[model samples]
Structures are given as structure tokens and as C-alpha cells.
Target: MKIAVMGAGAVGCYYGAMLARAGHSVTLVGRPQLVTAVQAHRLILEAAGRTEAVPVDATTDPSGVAGADAVLFCVKANDTLTAGRVIASHLGSSVPVLSLQNGVDSAEHLQAVLGRPVVPAAVYVAVDMPAPAHVRHHGRGELVIGPGPSSADIAEVFSRAGIPTEVSENVKGVLWAKLIVNCAYNALSAVAQLPYGQMMKTDSVPETMRDIVAECLAVAERSNVMVPGEVMSTVLGLAASMPDQLSSTAQDLAQGKESEIDHLNGYIVRAAARLGIAAPVNRALLVMVRLVEAKAQSARR
Candidate 1:
């Protein structure tokens, strides 16, 4: 299989390396820094206390996807449509593109831009890039993608590459569940500049999270998405399971990068409004994160 990873961030590098290690020809397209490092050495993947220099091709041009059999679209939510357009002319007309990103609408949005069907994938992993072309995996790495004509084959290939994968008929609900988790934690963590453990210890944090979860559930209900199981318990248990982990939003802020708050809590707020339901808690969190982002951007300026 020839795989093209559209983003060379942590998620892309980690999965691309796994496929390369499985003997698939993989190419990563991204920024110049990642391209330079990857072209010089292999993709340095650090996981489970071992480092593997996985061989793969790298390029800064989107045209690197020209002959790919499949593409892993891993850009940030805001870049979905733009990235889709950038790669559309380079991709095969019938190639399967998998969106392994956060937020519920990325796949749909990208599909619209490229005028093709895109598989939506819910990614469960803790990954980071300590340096360009170097990916570090901290914990679980599994994927649940929507059931489609090509889903089974994709899942099989991913599984063979040492990635746990499932083809789920309820991918919408799964994505909504992950979105709910992001909504409940990301903004608060970023605003406080705290990890899961310390963030939960702050005053009124639990109550705030409860309010956010309630609003998100209400929004999900309005969207007719059945988020199965004990959602509240799962949201509450995240801190205990990953005490020191910082939300991606927090990490983004710390790095002076644009956070994905608009796609997380802000999406909930807008969706709820469209359905005539108010998500005040989520709206507040969205604003708070935006304020922090503004401050960060201003400092950079």
C-alpha cells in the first residue's frame, strides 16, 4: 500500500511510521522543517521506551500524494477545507481519504471541498512531536472509523500495521462523544494553564465541567446523536486516567500556536444555537479560550 500523510504532526508521523514499519511505502507531506529532518534521517518514533528510526519518504509539497493509494488527512480543524483543496488535484479520483482529526465536521467539510467521500476516524492516542520528524507516543493509539465500502479493507490494513482499528456504524455518535470530551476539558485546561489533575482541583472546576458536559449532551441530543454509555462518568474519569496530560488547546497556547477552541466548544455553541438550544457554558469556555488565543497572538505580534 502506498500511504500519503498530509500532515507531518505527531499523529501523522506516528501512524505513518507504523505503516512504514509494516512495509508499506509511506510518504509524509508537510512543512519544510519536517521535510528536511525526515529526508535527512528516518522518522524517529519514540514509544514504550524504545526509539525506532522508521524509513519513509518526506516532502514539503502536497504533490507528494500524487501516486498514493490512500491519504491520512491529519491537519487541524481550521485547515480542513484548505488542505483538502491543496491536495485534491494531486490525489487519485477514487482514492480513499481518512480524516484522523479532532472535531466532528472535518471529514464532511473536507469531502465537500474535494468533491469526494471521506472516511471520518475517531483517534484515541496521546502523541507529541518533540522535534521535527520525531514523534513520541505517550499512550493508547486506536482508531474507530465510519463504516463504508472501503472501511473493512482499511481497518484490516491498519490492524496489520499494529494499529487497533474498528469499522463502526455509529461513527457519528463516536465522534460526538470525543467532541464532548474535548469540550468538557480543553478550554478550561488552556485558560488555567494546568494539566488534567491540577485543573480538576481548581475552585468550581468540577461544577463548571458538569455544566459544560450537560450542555454538550443537550446539544448532542438535539443533533440526534446517541452518545452511548455513562458519559458523565467517562468525562469525570479522564483526569484520573491522565493526570499530567495537558489538553491540546493548552499545549497549543503554550507553544504560541492557534488553538482549536472554535472547533471544540465553539462548535457546540453554534450547533446548539442552530437547533434553538442554548449552550451558555460551552459558549463561555469558547470565549475564554479565544481571549487567551488573542493574547498569545498579540504577544507574538
Candidate 2:
């Protein structure tokens, strides 16, 4: 399969590398820095106690997505529309765009701009880009993608590339389940500069996470959203599952880049408000993350 990874950050790069290693023709559309690094050393992937360099095409131009069989839209939640526009005219009309992003709305949001089918994928990967062109995968590279005409084909391609992919009719619920997990951990992890295992060990952190999960469930219920699974249990199990994993928001903050707090916990806050309810706990965490983001920005100056 020929694949193009748009917004080739950690999530994008990680999957791009895996597919490339599986002998797929993969191109990464990303920043100049990553292009430079890839030009020199190929795409560096560090995972499972080993590091390997995979030769893959990469360009700073969004037009790199032009000839792809599938495009993985993996930009941050807030940058969806902007990135979508950059690549809209370049993509083939029949090309499948799988949004492997942070928020629930990015796929549909991108589809509106491109006027093409966009597959919403619930990404279950713990990964980060520590350096230009270097992807350090923590654990779990699975996807629960929404139902569409091309979903089965997409899943087969991904699973063949070593990424477990499931086509789910309840993909929104999967996304919300993922969102609830993000709300419980992303802010706290970002604010504290601690990974999940370490953060869980801190006093009052588990209790605080429980509070966030409860509020998120309330928002989903009020919005008539069905969030499947034991979300609270999923929240509690993260410490053991991905112990060294830091939230993507944490990675952004650590690098002095803007974090996506507004889309995670802040999404819950707005949803609650729209339903004439309150999500004080989620709101508080949102505020705290914003404060830290502000601090990170100020210090960067």
C-alpha cells in the first residue's frame, strides 16, 4: 500500500515507520526539520528496546500526499482544518483519509473541507518524537476505526503492517473512551512533567483522576453520547499498561510548543456547558493545563 502521513508528528511517524518497515511505500509530509533528518538518516524508530532506521520518503510540502492510496491525518486537534486545507487540493478524490488524531471531531471536520470520505480512527498508541525524525514508541499500536465503505480495506492494510486495526460501528464511543482517558491523565501529566506510572504514585493523583472521569461520563451522558467500556477502570489501568508514557500534551509542553489541552479536558468542559451542566473538575484541570502552557510560552521567550 502507498501511504502518506500528513502532520507527521509522533503518531504519524510511528505508524509511517511501521508501514515502511512492512515494505509499504510510505511518505511523510511534515516540517523542514524532519525532512532534513530523514534525508540524512532515514526515519529513526526506537521501540521495544531497539532502534532501527527505515528508508522512507518525506517532504516538507503538503503536496507529498498527492499520490497516496491512503492518507493518515495525524495533526493535533486544533490544527485539523488548517492542515486539511493545505492538503485538500493535492489528494486524489478517491483516496481514503484516515484521521489518526487526538479529538473526536477531526475526521468529520476534515471531510467537510475536502468533500471526501474521511475515516475516524481511535488511535491507541503511546509514542512521541523526542528529536527530529525520531519516534520513540512506548507501547500499543492499535486502531479502532469508524465504519465506512473503505474501512475493512484500511484495517487489513494496517493489521498487515503490524498495527492491530478493528473496524467498529461504535467508533464515537471509542473516541470518547479515549477522550476520557486523555482528560484523566494528559493535563496532570503535562502539569507535573511526570509519566503515568510516576504520576499515579503521587498523592491524591488517583483520586483527582477519578473525579475527572466522573465529570467526563456526565458530559457524555448529557450529550446523548454512548461511551462504551469501563472508562474508569481503563483510567486506573494505565499505570501498569504504559508506565513510562507521558501524554502528548506533556511532550508538547516539554518542548515549549502549544499543548492540546483545549481539545481534551476543555472539550468536556464546553460540552457540559452546552448541556446546562457543570464539569468543575475537568474545568479545573483545563485551567491548570492552560496556566502551565502559558508558563511554558512565557519562558520560551
Candidate 3:
């Protein structure tokens, strides 16, 4: 099967490389820097302390999505609408698009813009790009995608590429569960520039995280999404599971790029407001990250 990866950052490159390695034709659409790197040396995938350059088609143009049987829409949450329009302009109405992003609402947002079906995918992975077109896998890489017309076929293809994938009818809950975890840690880590272990050492930090989690859960309940797992336990266990790892928001701020706080905590605040529910803790965290992101953007200017 031919696959197209939009916004070919770490997540896109990692999965695209896997599919390419499995003998599927893969094309990565992204910025000029990543396109140049991939064109010159393929995609460098580093996992389990081993590195291999996996060859695949690379382009800076959105039109690279053409002829793809499926698309992994991995753009940042803020870019969903714009990227969706771009894809819709280039592709036919039949190709399946999957939002393999950080937020709960991207698939809905993209579907609205494209006027086409989109599958929401809950991704459990900790991978980062150490350099352009290079993916460094840090932890789990499993996906639970929402049911759609082509979801089963896509899941089968992804599984064949060594990516553990399943189609879940309850993917919204899974997405919320992941979002809650992000809400609990992402902004705090970004603001302090600390890893999970060190962040937990700060006075009252764990309690504050619990408060944030509770707010997010309340917001989730208002939205009627059954957040899976023991939410508090999962939030607290993150430090032990990935002690040295910084949140993606932290990494984005460190790199002078905009973080996805608006989609994490900010999304909670919006949902709470819409549902006539209050989420003060989530609101505060959202504001804090927004301030930091604004400061970073100003520094760049």
C-alpha cells in the first residue's frame, strides 16, 4: 500500500520509516529542512540503540499526498484546519485520513475542514527528532484508532508494518485519557523545563498535578467521554515510567517552537466552558503555557 505522511516530524517519520521498511511505498510531506535531509540520507530511525537509514519519498509540497492510499495526518494541533484543506485540495475524497496527533479534537477539526471522513487515533509513543528527518524512539509505539469505514484495513496494514494497531470503538475515551495525562504534566514541565523525576521533586507539584487531573476529568465527564484507566494512578506513575523524559511541550518550547498547550489544557478549558463546567486548574495551566509560548515566539521575532 502507498502511504503519505503529512507533517513529517518525529511521529510521521518514525511510522513512515516503519512502513517503508516493510516494503510499502511511503511519501513524507514536510518542511524544506526535513525534505532535504530525507532526500539526502533517507529517514534515520534510532531505536533500541540501533540506527538505520530507511529510504522513502520525501517532499516539501502538500501535493506529495497524491496517489496515497492512506494518509497519516500528523500536523500540530494548531495546523489541523490548514493542513486538512491542503490535503483535501490535493487528494480524492476516498483516501482515508488518520489524525495521529496530540489532541482529542484534531480528527473532528480536520473532518470539518475537509468535509470527509477522518479517523481519530490515540497514539502511545515517546519518540523525538534529534535532527531533521531523524526519529529517536524512546518508548512505546502503539495506536488505537477510531472505527471508520477503512479503519480495519488500515489497522491491518499498520500491523503488517510492525506497528501494533487496533481499531477501537471507544477511541474517544482513550483519546481523553491521553489528553488528561498531557494536561497533568505538559504545561508544568514546559514552564519549569524539568523532566518528570525532577519536576516531581518540586514542592506541592504532585498535588498541583492532581488538581489539574481532576479538573480535566471533570471536563471530560461533562463532555461525556469515559476516560479509561485509573487516571490519577496513571498520572502519578508517569515519573517512574519515564523519569528522564521531558514532556513534548517542554521540548517544543526549548526548541523555540509553539507547544500544543492550546490543544491539551486549553482544549479542556474550552470544553468546560461550552459545557457550563468550570476548570480553573486546567485554565491556569493553559494560560501559563500560552504565556510561555508567546514569550518564545517574541524571542524568535
TM-score of each: 0.96, 0.98, 0.96
Question: Which runs of model 1 end up more than 4 angstroms from their true locations?
Answer: none
Kindly list the per-residue Cα lDDT of model 2 for residues 51-128, writing each as its tens digit.
999999999999999989999998888998999999998998788889998877778898898888888999999998
> Can you list the residue pairs that collide in candidate 3?
none
Q: Which one is best on lDDT?
A: 2
Please, what are the lDDT tens digits per residue for candidate 3 over residues 2-50? 9999998888988998899999999999999998998889899998889
lDDT by residue (4-120, candidate 1, tens digit) is 999778899999999999999999999999988987888999988999899999998999999888899999998988898999999997889999998999999998999989999
| For model 3, the run of ten residues with the poorest summed lDDT | 84-93
Model 3 alpha-carbon miss at residue 84, Å? 1.0
Q: What is the Cα-based TM-score of model 2?
A: 0.98
lDDT, candidates in the order shown: 0.90, 0.91, 0.90
Q: What CA RMSD would you report for each candidate?
A: 1.3, 1.0, 1.4
After TM-score superposition, the amount by which residue 110's alpha carbon in candidate 1 deviates from its true location, in angstroms, is 0.6
Model 2 regions more than 4 Å off = none
- Which prediction has more favorable lDDT, 2 or 3? 2
lDDT of 3 at 288: 88
